[model samples]
Target: MEKRWLPLYGNNLEAHSTIENRSLTDLLNDTTAKYSDNTAITFYGKTWTYKELQKFSEALAASLNGDQFKKGDRLAIMLPNCPHYLFSLFGTFRAGGVVVQVNPMYVARELEYILNDSEATHIVILSDLYPLFKSVRDKVPTKKAIVVALKPGAEIELEANDCLFESYLKQATAPAPAITIEAENDLAVLQYTGGTTGVSKGVMLTHLNLVSNTEQTYDFMFSGEVSPPPNARIVNVLPLFHIFSLTCCNFVTIRHGGNQILIPRFDMPEVLETIKKEKPFQLGGVPTMYVGFNQVGKYKEFGLDLVESYVSGGSSLPVEALEAFERGTDRKLCEGYGLSEAAPVTHFNPSFQERKAGSVGIPLPNTDAKVVVETDAGWEEVAVGEVGEMIIKGPQVMKGYWRKPEETERTLRDGWLFTGDLAKMDEQGYFYIVDRKKDMILASGYNVYPREIEEVLYQHEGVQEVIVLGIPDPYRGETVKAYITPKPNSTLTSQEIIEFSRKQLAAYKVPKAIEFREELPKSAVGKLLKRKLRDEELAKVEAEQSS
Candidate 1:
């Protein structure tokens, strides 16, 4: 309820009482008009100027409309990071259609649910992934599909209902249809959260929500700079379908009229070489990417000093990685926090001010947060430094979960969003996430947070990566178990990890079980999949009990 971070907010940064309540295309159009000749995108060795990118988007939009895809319709876009992603996104907005972001990694079963649930009538998919969609095509309601092969001539079977992406664009060189947009009410993107805890639901993000978030992210990142320097280049390797990459990388690059250098995937050597060649002023990615940067240990050699700002989101950046990055590059890797429900960014460490290593920093401009715990009576705001669920209220917050009124009601209370994340705020307003509310382990009636144990385990030399979770225990109700990936060439054992953890953690807090693996499960953006590992362990326990 109080603005504890206000006193610390500086660098000429002031909150905007009202951001532009306009469609995302308004942002795209203004940038295109202002910087028509600017190089908008660079994919491999090819580049697209603003004029060319806009013309392509217009052509795609006209063709989609000509093909009977009308306003208010949903068009799924499933592609990796490339120029095609930008075209599909802006084209959907101009065509008055809602964009449904589908992960390129999704299989038939996972893909079918989103296609059916969102009632998407069309999809723009990758040629490589076309057969996967074809496998489940008859089961879904999609009428048309546009398959894109970045490198043409890769054989892909196409029915009469499907067309090649270039062919689809060439069919209509007509101007974009003039479609009126109700920015506040009209849907922009149906961003689906990873179905870790349960079924993934489509988050209804209106044009106003996304545009507002883009503005907020820009202001927070640049410290209220009017515009980035001329010809600024942004090197992005994060997946395009991810909201974090969409807003922070794609949207921000548009706002700045900067050059976006794209990499198809996270090939560490390529990323480093691109940074050196392109001389981008900023770099952003998940914790794992930062870890890879540290592992490669080529910050100075790769000319990382050219990049002045480094951002980490999608998941928490391990403190160890953060420290290692600073030691390697002599620069801070600022970590922030957000969720799909809030256009994915609400707080980031202040770029020009004191940054706490573990905290997710304070709320962004025009946003507010409180750490509140639910009591037997009702929800109550927790005292400073006390652990509780974090609640947020901001213009970036999603309108609601699509078609799921009950879920929408449960997650959005009054004007605040119940994030379902356990956290605490210091007196200075910096927030430290304890863990997910559902991830607390009860060992001998004592609450054990997996993140707390995981952080301690990270200090061990042999442990490369670790995930901790609660397992059913006969006497303790639930015991803590850890799944770990040991460093290459390390002679680490389960007993050694247990003995190491015992020294740093209380006896009850120590992991009762340890399982070693070559690697841990990760999401599309490389966030560790704790729930997936927990589910597998639970399934094994169920089988043991039955036997």
Candidate 2:
């Protein structure tokens, strides 16, 4: 079999090369040694140099070690992007512990499941979220919790055993103790992603997996049309909890000795102002953020042109966004593709090569990707340009789902990670994502599983049958809409269900629209056909677009 993309490789990128085995700590270590004085992270009014970042990480590590945080202990981080997030990450790695990524917006019900399932004994959370954690504290196994208050003089009442971040860091000043880390076998992070059934599955990523992916990302990107000098200031507003940002933005930037400006949340005016003031060379964001910029429609005034490189990930890039970027800024918006299973990144449209607007360019070095169709004979590789399931084999692939053997087997087959993403590879080896095989909805770059919402709606006595699906929205790439069959003589309003879901689930997971239906499309076996509902929605979207 010929590697069609081999021809497109530049002099800098090798089609195949030996991936160096290392740990995530080296990303900071190597850079800190060379660029200690370079600014590493900037959040709000505070800034940290590489040396300060390492010092804080070591301090946090010492605090954890002093508090009996042993190797392999799961430490859940439930805070948004801030300097504290970086400290927690490196601190955990330095302590030879595993970092579990948890969304900060999780409601009490959703929060309890992740903490208890991961068996995380320690958690570093924002002070604003203390009440939420306090509500579920008794339900989880967490023995220690550190609360960080970003606001000045903000008071958060804590348990007697719990402590404030400032207090915790006071004791983290000693030298980091020696601990052996087996990068290949030892788990470094547990990235929780939604399973097919809407259950949360913790993706077990080894240090080697993250390290290899970081290196691959660097070579594939820097060895291209993008050749930023070391310590270049970078704009990073993507939430650090997400795999896309964690690996691509945080890991890659720290390793590259770059200064990253962190924004806690997206506010268009604030973002534009930051870009104007900071004048960073590059920015990484999702389609929603780019669309936000597109909505502003003021490229030159806000200094959007100051940034040299703009990359999009986390979800599909609306071609409108790409075109809007080009029209407004005369700069290309590179869209990449990846999933949490493959340490989150497998393909990126290169800047050095013939950049395709719709295609997620070829696989990274040493990564083998194939689009295959499952038939009675077995899984057969589909011809180029044919849509099929994208499967990948690479060093960057994760070990397995944490503690879920059956789910592990289902996703990983023989050394290949089965990505349930519908895609087709061009003859030139560029891959294009057509749709998702699973009923996962991407709303504003967040994965909203239909089964999870249906399961929640089922608990409501007013709902007899329910189906959730994604619909086209101009703002959100896809907005969730629920088709619900009410119980006889029951009245349920969209507002009522939305309010209920807002209390139980995260804001993004809640359905934005609801429709009362007499019946939903079903198969001959009377099984509710989600695919049919999706098809109908797509048809409706198509009709709307045409009109």
Candidate 3:
């Protein structure tokens, strides 16, 4: 059979080869050399030119030495989307140590787990979280030093507590010794994600992996019209700790010399205010974000009326939400797909084309994707139009899970990374994600994806948020159940939600039972914790049966 190429994916492959020749530092320096006088970052109304960002990063790199930190040591950063966060992270990378990104919203429990698991010797945290650190410091045995950043608009309360973030920067000495790092050999970052079995493991990304992925992302995004729009502004509210923002919003923005207006956290009014002020060209978010943003009462006030592009990822983008956003912004929400292991970008929609709503566009330039179909005998390759595990091989795949060789071996076979995501391809070469393997629900001897049912629920005007999961059932082994959070000021009942879902979903896909909650439990990064909800429902059933 002849090889197939996806539309718009070829142009990026050509550009990526050119980028492969340079090291990450070489790329950073090149961008600074050309756009040094241009603004590279804007946060809290302050702008940093490419030159200033480079100089600050160099100075921060200079402050670390034998007494403070050493080359190849792990340095974790826990902060929001602030200028200091970016400066500290890239500086750590420039200093030759690995950057371990931790979510700023992490509680003591989450912080302790990540700190202990990564065995990070040093950390930079925001001052507002100092008390949480004080609580968990004893639990994190490997952490040797801590630097705090003054939380914007918040008072520093950790002065009496051992180390003040400001005081340490004041005692800065000469630049640290220059260290050599192989673009291919050195570990650049450890971004953590949850597992199907419960434990969370760190996904180890390398410099070459990130650089190559960024280049591919840029090429695909700009492949359509020969020239990208000038002085593009992007609204970045996604946490920088996430792979999506780290590549598309932060690193990619710096590479392109784009102006970024950062929103520390997602607030409808605040986001609207920023949109009104900046009138950005791009909006990057997950499925839930668009759902919330599209429902704002003052949608016309944001001036997104003329926004050019909106990219959705991190979760499945519902066709309903996409349509709603288009009606509000008069623009389509381009959907992409990736995982933390793949430098977080394996596929994205072409910027200048008519997109299929449910598809995740095509494999990025230089990225190869194949369907690994599991059969009764063993796994085998499936042709187009078949659904199975989406195996991808590209420059973006991570080095491996940090310190978990067996798990790494299970995930990365030969050169392809088996993502455990179920998907199928069309004759035209567009890929449509069905659902995750672990998320597939077996009901009445049939397979069902919760996303299909949840999407139906989202179509209901009254349903603000919904999570569909498999609950224990003696008759069927497992049955579909939905937990929903209604829209504000609305009185939506479980029966009503189930009735609404029944109108759209097949009988087997419809929830056998429904539960209502003020809010659903989510990860620090806002991804739904379906496992938690499933466990809660199972516990309730077990207790009821016992009674």
lDDT-best of 1 and 2: 2
Stretches of candidate 1 exceeding 4 Å from the true structure: 194-197, 224-227, 439-547
Put down candidate 2 lDDT per residue, 1-547, tens digits, no spaces.
Answer: 4678877886868876556677878768988999999999988867899999898888888988988889999999999889999999998999999999999999998889999999998999999998888889899999788998999888777896899988898876566698888899999999999956999889999999999898888778878767677688787888888999999888888878999899988888888999999888889988898888888898989888867888898888888778888789887778899999999889988878888888888898889999999999999999988999999999889999999999999999999999999999898889999888898888998988889989998989899999998888877899999999999999788988998888888999899999899998889999998888778888988988899
- Candidate 3, 1-547: lDDT as tens digits: 1235454454434524445644456566778888888777778788888788787777667765634677778888888887777777777877888888887766565688889998887778777776777787788854544455554456565533345545554446687676787888788889987555435689988888888888888877766653335556888998888889989887777678777778788777788888898888788887767777766745677787767777887766667778878887777678998988999888877766658888898778778888778789877878888888998998889899999999899999998899989998877677888767767665533446677677778888988888888876643446798888989998887678777766555466678888888899999999988879877877898899799
> Judged by TM-score relative to the true structure, which candidate is superior, 1 or 2?
2
Please give each candidate's TM-score.
Answer: 0.81, 0.98, 0.78
Scored by lDDT, model 1 comes in at: 0.84
**Compared with the true structure, what per-residue lDDT tens digits does model 1 show for residues 1-547?**
6789987776457866358878988988899899999999999889999888888888889998887878999999989888988899999898999999987866666688889998899899999988878888899998788998998668878986699988899887566679999999999999986323335689999998888888888887887332368767888888887888888888988888989898878888889999988888777787767777777896888988658778888756667778888888887778899888999889989876788999999888899999998889889998999999999999999999999888899899988999888999998989998777567665543446677678879999999999888887643556789999999999998899989876666576789899999999999999999879878877998999799
Between candidates 1 and 3, the lDDT winner: 1
Ranking by lDDT: 2, 1, 3
- The local lDDT score (0 to 100) that residue 452 gets in candidate 3 is 61
Pairs that clash in candidate 2: none
Name the runs in model 2 displaced over 4 angstroms: 172-174
Identify the candidate with maximal TM-score: 2
User: What order do candidates take by TM-score, descending?
Assistant: 2, 1, 3
Residue 497, model 2: lDDT of: 91
Report lDDT (CA) for all predictions: 0.84, 0.88, 0.75
**Which lDDT value does model 1 have at 298?**
68
